[model samples]
Target: MTNLAKRIIEFVQRPGYMPMKPKTLAKKLGITKKKLAKFEAALEEAKLSGEIRFSEGGRIQPKAARGSHLGIVHRIKSGDAFIILREPKPVGLTDDIFVDRNDLKDAQNGDEVFVKLLQRRRSRGQRCGYVVEVVERATNVFVGTYLEEDESGWVQIDGKDYPDPIWVGDPGAKGVQEGDKVVIEMLRFPTVGQNGEGVLTKVLGSRGEPGVDTQMIIHEFGIPDEFPDDVLNEARLEAENFNENDLTDREDLSEMTVVTIDPKTARDFDDAISLKKIEKGHWLLGVHIADVSHFVQPGTQLDREAETRGTSVYLPTKVIPMLPEIISNGLASLQEGRTRFTMSAFIEFSAEGIPIETRFSRSAIKVTQRFAYEEVMPIIKAKPSEPIEGVSDEIRELLKNMHELAMLLRKRRFAKGSLELDMPEVRLSLDTDGKVTGAFEAEHDESHEIIEEFMLAANIAVAVRLNDEGIGFLRRAHADPAEAKLKAFSEFVTILGFELEKYQSKKHLQALLRSVRGTPQEQAVNYAMLRSLKQAEYSPMEVGHYALAEDQYCHFTSPIRRYPDLHIHRLVSSLVCDNVTYRGASAEDLIRLGHHCSTTERRAERAERELTKIKLLTYFEERVGEKITAVITGVERFGFFCRGVEIPAEGLVHISNIPASESYEFDRQAMALVGRRTGDMIRLGDKVIVEIASVDVDRRELNFKLLTHTASKPPAKKGAAKKSPSRGKKGSKKPNSKQSKPRKKKPSTRKKKSAQKRRKKR
Candidate 1:
């Protein structure tokens, strides 16, 4: 075989290789126009010799011996799709196989399908395949807006997944008006050449109405909002059965100065804290978490419901509690001056913040005070000589001690190589009608850090104890990232002009992060690093957390919100109070439960993010053409994405929108777009002023037009006399263009003449 044929075979055999057309394949292989004929001749020869094959769409592929593999389809808006394999992937095969839109057949997004791998290869060595059969449908229910055109009813799905309107024979079937937000049950999913058919199942409300967006999201994501009657009844029974005086099998620590510090808007207080200086200058810290297991017993209706929900979903305008509010916000809440049952972790730490001993106990405690995060810092900062009026000396002293220990612990945590990538939280200010008024970055001050440190201590202590007892509990695990990913991140930072000696070394990564601290490249570098790392998830496996730098870690802090914590609480309750080892869920059961909880957690996060974008898009609809300062977060071939520094809304700035005489080419290595003539670079982390071009609320897309570009570092000049386009004036025309003379608009006339000719020919 020739060298070109050998290269083709080798590329096709490589993992993740997708099928591509001849032109695309040549471009990917860097075959210039002069060498295109030879490349095509070699490809044809290879195809004729049975070394490779061509798909029906004329994309080249390798001949696969296997028939089909079960996978889940994820279709993109461009009609192309990738299949995530369910079966054990072949040694040389990728976990996902790319499918061309023509080969996708009738497969929809998220459908489980059987895919037959093609014998061809595409760019980046990605493997390509085609869907053979769809095994299962992900969902038939969809949220959309009702529409009526010439008395024909339709439901326009509110996402890119289904761009076309579904034919819903009669819009008024479910009392849905023309512009009402409704849920449709798909009778027939749409194909490329056909429209979909569905029936109106539910009328949420009129489109753009208050609370309709939230309802749409809830139905769209299939998030359970309403509790079952039995679960609510169980919660009510638990509330009625509760008695504060009955402290059976529980240690009474009501006299201790325990306090709950949370956000001002917090309603469900799950954890409380108490600290005192003890003998030998050791500090005894008590971390009291509401014993939700005490109210939500195992195998009961409440437990079943909570287990299914996995965790509470905190939306911008709503909170979907795992357990009913009767339990989560009432009996389980550690309200100030109220006696609450809790599973407590007591840790004795030296003055230097080294934990010496850890103990667990089932206890009852009355919170001395409920301090908001804003209140704690002020009390901690108050001088002893000048105490704040109406504040007790005991509360003030306790706050001071908590702050000191927490800071010491935080310092030690960083010293031990814990990754600190905490970005300020973007909170939206919503009106009573659920429309976004404004947004602000919530402060993550010392007060928040104090609570965070105590929670980490408690969680680590519990994990250590459980592991020592040989218990099989769901652990919060974060595996180390792949070496390739780290290397990629290292190269990315290097392009941004940061030195990271060893990408694999946690210490080096930490140092690099510290060097970029408070710099212009901080957010970009941090975001890149976060993307390189694996997501933290609940698992029974003993994979340690990479970011926390902990060998043992689990969720044991917020039992009121998290189901895993409740399970951990039960195990601790049995070990501490019953004096018996609780053989929790079996390994298999724990694995399944962990997977479910992790999935629910991700779903909640995605729903929240999507809703926030929707609200932000709605707010920006009125501000179209308004210029705002933004930082480029991502760069791609077509455009770069930027987020407003002040508003935190992200939008895409297409390359076409750049006021340049010459087109821009993507520089993959530099992760930027370079002007062909001007050498101006629009790279990641570059600051740019952009005008809001348009907002597509239905599709949840925000588009921006670049008004100006400021590179983080000045680009090298391609020519001494050439001026960069970055210096162009607002609404500037293309360079050297005849701007004074108005150009004739003859394209539409020509198009009409051509159309008339085509019609006459037909």
Candidate 2:
């Protein structure tokens, strides 16, 4: 019976309530008299089943609101859960609220459930709760394999743990077959004792299908794979119409030596550089960016769409563009030989890369050449090849000079503790059918850094100008890493036999970074340090970014894909033109905008990873049982995560799969897990070999078996402990009889240092 229906029948069968007035019943039940009459009628309908009998002059006692613990379910594991109470500090609440194997009652991770606050337990500061009511359910549109035929099959989803099989109803099932990757919509949320219903919303593709990974990526990131019709129509209309009046009062740089340098695969050219000699000591270095603000105005449909997207998401196989193709790839693109509108930054720098003066202007520019990174790097390195088509010798010399200045500027920036982190980017080469024929690392060469330096200079210049005027503007904020996290990281690196210099200023950080240069663990250390820091976000606050060591920083380079850049364009154009009468948003508005963009940006990141995981899973299906060298990327109670050094794909090495008798202990502060009995540790960045054991494309999970040199005796097996099957139909390997329980590791031997030393001296 439905929950609501059952509650109503129970109320009518209360002892001694058959002859009460409808008004009294309504008041007692917290409902109107008419609703109470309906409840009475429902009881009569149930008489056909002999499940209800009317009683006279009876009333049910009201249940009082009892004290309860309120918190979001942090996680569910081993028939128990950890809850994070909203009101507590440090967020370490002990809800060891045991939900026995048979009593989980359909609870899912991240659900909002209220548990009766039971008496205090032995663990200090930890509160246990008996789950009273489930206020909400965590529902996600899942991608899984379909499992049925005869046009009446159900889909066995990947994440849900089911006793009785849960499946999608027949009509809700699209034309998906067994093992097809399909998207399903939750039809019902799981209640206290029932599994929720769901239906198949879309049939993405079969397992190991090309391009399906990208589809999963966009979906997981909550990015729309296709533009809404209204947004598309508006974008198309904006492209078809243009006016000459749009260029009024703009500086015309059509005759200058303007050039664009980008990757060969890049489509939208949003930025370009121009060089011209104004005097013996002064040269005009113009950094021009496409004026996307002129086309996409605030409050317009196009503007809303771009703002919602925040930034374009780039995947290995495809690009989910922030703007429609009509603008991003066609009109707004600053392609060579095409006339485009730009907001240019003109900086006069000395021969030694010191800025003497700066000028900002809205201008019309025509690019004369477009050179790929590989083609331009040689020219900048003074080893010139054949001249770029339509480029003069003077312009080549200007390019060389620009390269020299950019390098110096980059050196200064990094010297200020900017963190010289350049992770390897995974690039996929796909065939015409979109199958990934090859995957490799894409390196950032000198050509990429040159353009980056110029863009950075331009962005900083714009932010400083706006801040000087006392106007509200979007500033990218990156605070110093938390003291706790930094301390933890320091302990970790020190344990690895590295000395991190302690300093009072950003210079100290830079010194430590220089010491790790060219080391094998350089990338690993960089990744760990980065994790200790918070993400950069947009804000109107004057607090500067500690990492960049900049007094001002803002987004102004890529307006086509990022909305904040468009705002920067409008603000700069108004200031440059002395049109200060224009009204702009306040600081509060910018803060709100930053919060929204930051949240959506995280969503976009998730989508990208989901797609990558699916492709990686498909890639592994072909390599089962093949051994590959990998690095320890993560460690948990369940297993150690090893990422292939060459492939960028990661898999798990479960504790049960470890052949050593040593127990594993996780160093929470050091972010590493170590083995106790055998002194066999699996720390982050340790190299090891693993063989692919299983792959679950539907769930996008990979499992690997560890290759150990010595087979340590296994722990005694408990009676009839069933092993959870590895995702495929094949039976999983049983634990060896010699395996033993891993011993808990002891605390580190290092002395705990005081935080007073970390603080700046007054």
> Quick one: best lDDT, which candidate?
1
Query: Tens digit of lDDT per residue, candidate 2, span 314-385?
Result: 776788888898899987899888889888999887655667888998898888888898887667665566
RMSD (CA, angstroms), candidate 1: 14.9
Model 1 spans > 4 angstroms off: 1-67, 86-89, 579-582, 714-762
- Please, what's the RMSD in Å of model 2? 14.9
Per-residue C-alpha lDDT of model 1 across residues 1-762, encoded as one tens digit per residue: 679977877776565566666778888878899998789778866776775665422456665445777678888769899898863476667558999988988789988666887888788778898887655566678998889986778999997898889999954776778888899899888887888998888999886789989998898888999999999988898888999999988899999999889999998999999999999999999999999989988889999889888889989999999989988899999998899999999999998999999988889999998888998887887777885876789988889999999999999998898988856567999989999999988888999999999999999999998999888999999998888888878767766656676777778888888887776667778889999998999999999999999999999999988999999999998888564635578775687688778878888898898888888998999899899999998999989999899999889998888776767877776677877555667787789999999999888889999988887752222231123222236664322111111122346778999999999999
Q: Which TM-score value belongs to model 2?
A: 0.75
lDDT for model 1: 0.83
Best by TM-score: 1
Off by over 4 Å in 2: 1-140, 148-154, 158-167, 243-246, 276-283, 350-352, 384-391, 503-505, 577-582, 637-639, 659-682, 708-762
Residue 393, candidate 1: how far off, in angstroms?
Answer: 1.4
Give the TM-scores of the predictions, in the order they appear.
0.83, 0.75
CA lDDT, every model vs. true structure: 0.83, 0.67
Candidate 2 lDDT at 180 equals 74
